[model samples]
Target: ARVMVAMEAELQQHPAQGVLVVGDVNSTLAAAVSAKKLHLPLIHVEAGLRSGDRNMPEEINRLATDAITDLFFVTEPSGQEALLREGHPASRIHFVGNVMIDNLFHQIGRLRADPAAGGRGAALRAGLGDRPYGVVTLHRPSNVDHPEQLAGLVGTLRTLASDLPLVFPVHPRTRSNLSRFGIDLGPNIHTTTPLSYMEFLCLWKDAEIILTDSGGLQEESSAVGVRCVTLRDSTERPVTITDGTNILAGTNPARILDVARTALAQPASGKRPLLWDGRAAERILDVIVDSPLFQPV
Candidate 1:
């Protein structure tokens, strides 16, 4: 909180001509506040997302950001509608698609070009050792704050590990919860530090199933044609659910295990086509460059 306040003060002192704040909804609120004070136009790249739970802080940030942002760069039609329903003028919302898709497409090409690709693949093969593996990541505070809920999630993973290995790239928050709740990670569960974006993309591409509470990973998993089991009770990205690429398993141990087993058994074969064509940044740039509001002083 102190850091955010300090940074905001600094930005206020020397405001840039155009400022774009991307990633995590928390910064959205800060951007909104900053825009109001600095008189700089704020562009929310992946805006209009709402988990519908104000207790989550992210929902609060999303609402606050959308309320004050001059332009909304949405990922899907639903996101656009969300902004509209919030009383934002239609002219302000532009469906520029998801930037994560752009990152994935770019990184996939990089991985192919790198000579270490073969070595990484080899390491993954050795680590997995012919065993089908599912990737799991849980970071939402609602799920991890409660000991019973956290234990249930871990139990579900343990049950799924009976058939296939569950690779968990443990987020620091989740690790802390595990230690706090005294939840044990079994032999079949492999926990590692948070992976780089490229490494995570490779893992998502290769995983038999992805069980996660992350919105970005859900989208990426679907883009790569991988089956995903969402651990949340509900999602802001309903496109994944409607497209049949992801299933909401909530936090129930039995349901998580059951849905994960089902997803692994019948993985989606054809890519269901991503919401964006990996040109969101370019589109946003075009909009900003062409808009009358973007004139240079």
Candidate 2:
């Protein structure tokens, strides 16, 4: 109710002809619902992604958002196909590549240009220091929302930590759950507060491998040619698994351990997905500019 009320007030003051919501989240869903209630055209960026798991709330958000979206700016071929399969008009769906990659490319350039900007490089080097190590990040509700699952995941990581040093920037929710569940975050795994993007990227770029439940990490790892193990049964961004260096491990500790070991032992290789070039933001703007909704009135 609070989200709806705030959206209503914002739109009333601004009087937009339509709303364009990006990615799947509570905000995205709220905007989608508000736009439809206002009888305004809705545009959805990164539309038609599905993890095929009905239990995940993000999957439901994607479904609801895509249903009401007047225009679909997809990020990949599979997204276009997903929209087509669901009976959406192909004319309304435009494959505009990945806008997130544009920001990633920019930040990487900034990090490379000013190595001293964040002190990220030195911090990373000081922690791992010429030794190969793995990075771990887990924040998905499915992974950490429950007591048993969170404890199991943490315990598994603790075991893996003995094999190779694992760095984890703990999410607040995970930390609370660790305390609530009486799970000891063992010393073998290094834990820190959540890091800024540059600092996190610094750690990620130098890691031997990454084990995560994050959608963005999958794409980033694939983009930068790093080995990644996804801790989910399915991924909405299938391109990461199909073309990139991502391997799905679900929540099974044994499976995760097996994949991590194999990943560390093997020589690394990965292929970039189509149209992930740094100009994706430009393409998105081009579509929005040419759209009938935004034309001179």
The CA lDDT of each predicted structure is: 0.78, 0.86
For each candidate, give its TM-score against the true structure: 0.91, 0.94
Model 2 agreement with the true structure over 124-243: per-residue lDDT tens digits: 657677788889998888899898888888878888889889888889988888888898878878888898888888778768899999988998888878999999999999998888
Number of clashes recorded per candidate:
0, 0
Each model's RMSD to truth, in Å? 2.4, 1.7
lDDT of 2 at 34: 92
Give the poorly placed runs of model 1, Cα more than 4 Å off: 1-14, 115-125, 269-275
Relative to the unseen true structure, what is the Cα RMSD of model 2? 1.7
List of clashing residue pairs for candidate 1? none
lDDT for 20 (candidate 2): 86
